[model samples]
Target: MVIFGVVQIIFSQIPDLHEVWWLSIVAAVMSFSYSSIGLGLGIGKAVEKHADYGSLKGVGIRDVFHDADKTWSVFQALGNIAFAYSFSMVLIEIQDTIKSPPAENKTMKKATTIGVAVTTLFYLSVGCVGYAAFGDNAPGNLLTGFGFYNPFWLVDIANICIVIHLVGAYQVFSQPLFAFVEEWCSSKWRNSNFINKQYTVKLPGYGPLELTLFRLLWRTCFVIFTTLVSMILPFFNDIMGILGALAFFPLTVYFPIQMYIVQHKVKPWSRKWLILHLLSTVCFIVSLAALVGSVAGVVARLQQNYKPFKTTY
Candidate 1:
């Protein structure tokens, strides 16, 4: 989306105000989506799960194979590998970006604050301008959508942006899982394959014939799986949200509460945290129900007919 905006800003013939608006909406949505994965839900639960499972060292090959076996197919296994690699890459990038500056100098603190504030204001301006120009015609994507309705040139620019944005998103999203596998491989291998991974911001290198072989086969499958899905379901944003909500939402909310309950067993807990835990669990349950209910609502909405605003000859 950021890439889309940058390209649109550079190439779109839409009024400056209108271009800004569409870009703003896409940016806001992307920010929220990425943030939610990293902080809002998944990260917390993953930490607790790892701790409970006794870190990577405590797990065995059978455990890995057993888990892998449960995958829907060989393709799904590959998808999981690629997904992990992608997730790790993103996490590492974010960690590096966030960490390097803080450790380097005291001036970074002030600079960071100013940078964030300016970015926020810029996004707000875009949103306001987009709403003013498109009104109800505004779609989630400025270039792809606006071009469809108004000007083909605007969409052409948007398509370019979307391609770049997809690459960036893939680069970031794959980091978390990639880093985990890389670290695990490093522990087992003394070779430069693992060392070379430090330079590139993509998937990390592998070692240990067993682990490397598994990941190679797995990641290959993942690319194919994701490719098929992307082709079949091109509605990326909403689908991503729904998948995130179900898998991530549960993993985030329930796992932590389980950890806390287990950690504090035989001890009385304070009412505040207890209440918070209860509320968290309830929210998850409600969200699950709402998601299920939405399917029916979508079907009903789709089945409804809309009147054409004009007559054709």
Candidate 2:
């Protein structure tokens, strides 16, 4: 993850998503391949009646609601799922990459519909097959559960694909944050040549350079900071749950609906206004619950003295 973060920071210098569009395609293909491999292996194991299969024999829909004595786990799971579906946070930024007359709304709607449909199918296949293969003992990451001695090469391939996909995905998600920070810095250092796009910095021993030292420095620092945090708190699931809860409602549910209500001039007491507000309120409650659940989970883990930089599986 740290390596990927550094790679993302370097690639973010490109400044235009369209120029790196092929990266997204490659990442998508790698991600799909990885998921497909996981599903196939899981189903194969189940069908072959591997030793683990007996554990899953009684699994059913009811198992989905079981929480292993952790009442708040369901909320954290919901938060993770919500975060997975919350691309609205970056939708507009993605649309801006399209050529004008943008037709951005129409294009974005079509893209989102297709993306969600495909992602849903993949998630369902992997989740169901994995659970069927290992029951309540299913590993948080399917790849990790596969021992190194069995199908070692295949496991390596799947893990590699995941790394490649995450490399691109990190860039896609981090670009917005990079842009936000850069804009703020530029605004603050208005008199700097770096902010003026002329990059006039020169050294006594070297010729003038077009490089923006401040931009490079800040972006590098940001990547280092994130890398340090990842190293310090490497609990992937817990971190995902926390981030999901913190971001889901505000980014995925609230802001979009609020913007639509305002844009359409939906009046109070009207059907649209009432419906929108109702949905927002429900999301708000869910977000709060998820937040509490995630915090509690983290605290419990800490109390247990869980080791950092170690794989939970």
Candidate 3:
């Protein structure tokens, strides 16, 4: 995690999301690398070993809490799924990076369609195959779970790909946040040199570049703050579940549907309105359940003597 923070600190200095287009490409490649490896390993295990391993009712209680009933695990699984698909929350920010000979929104829509389809395929394949391979004993983490221990070097490569992918994913999600805060602060303190000033410096081979004292300090502090938070609540999947549950409903579903209704000026009690509201309500219920389950998972972990900075890898 410290290594993650350090890498983030360096890339977070890149100033803008568009500046890290190469990073995005690299991260996407790393994502495919690991996903393919995981999917391939699972397929190999299923074909070579017990081809018929899983039960129809899903795996036993081995995901996080072995003693808890299936309901909590199923609810927590909802949150995990939400987290996996929550990358759409960053789509608007990402869309701003597109080059525009074609209409940007049109391009974004097409790209999003492809991206979602591809990700869904990969995620479902990797997940179902892994479950089939290990049956009731599948670990929460695929590559890092040491489930594919025989191919140590390949597993190692997949893990490394995960690390690289996360490094870029962190910045992809964070740069917009940094921008928001910096823009707000600059506007709030319009004439303050410390807040609004940009400094130009020449790098050894990179030539002149602009820097800001406030950005340097504020972004660094922000990274440190989030790093500390991660260390404190190191329940990776549970934390993801919590964040996913919190962000999924409003960001991913509700707001867009509401905007569409308003833009189209749909009648308040029409079929469209009724359908949209019904969908929103259902999503809200799912999100609420996921949040509760994930929180329970965290509480359960805490009861098992988990401590900050003391958890063994």
TM-score for every candidate vs. truth? 0.43, 0.85, 0.94
State the weakest 10-residue window (summed lDDT) of model 2: 51-60
Model 1 vs truth, CA RMSD: 18.8
Give per-model CA RMSD.
18.8, 4.7, 2.1
Error of 1 at 44 (Å): 41
Candidate 2: TM-score?
0.85
Candidate ordering by lDDT (highest first): 3, 2, 1
- Per-model lDDT: 0.41, 0.74, 0.86
- Give the alpha carbon lDDT tens digit for every residue of 225-274 in model 1: 55555544444333443444455334545655667667767244678567
**lDDT per residue, candidate 3, 175-274, as tens digits?**
8898999999988999989888899977776677778999989889989889988888888888889999999999999999999999999999999899
TM-score for candidate 1, please give it. Answer: 0.43
lDDT of 2 at 211: 48
Best by TM-score: 3
* Candidate 3 wrongly placed segments (more than 4 Å): 50-52, 59-68, 145-148
lDDT: the better of candidates 2 and 3: 3
Stretches > 4 Å off in candidate 1:
1-93, 96-142, 148-154, 179-215, 247-271, 293-313
Model 2: per-residue Cα lDDT over 1-313, one tens digit each: 6667768676655554565677878888999999988887887777764536534244344554444425566666676677785567667788888775648778888889999999999888887787777776777688776774367888889999999897777777777776787788788988877554645555555445444766677767877888778877766666787888888889888888988988888888898888889999998898888877777667666666667766342
Top candidate (lDDT): 3
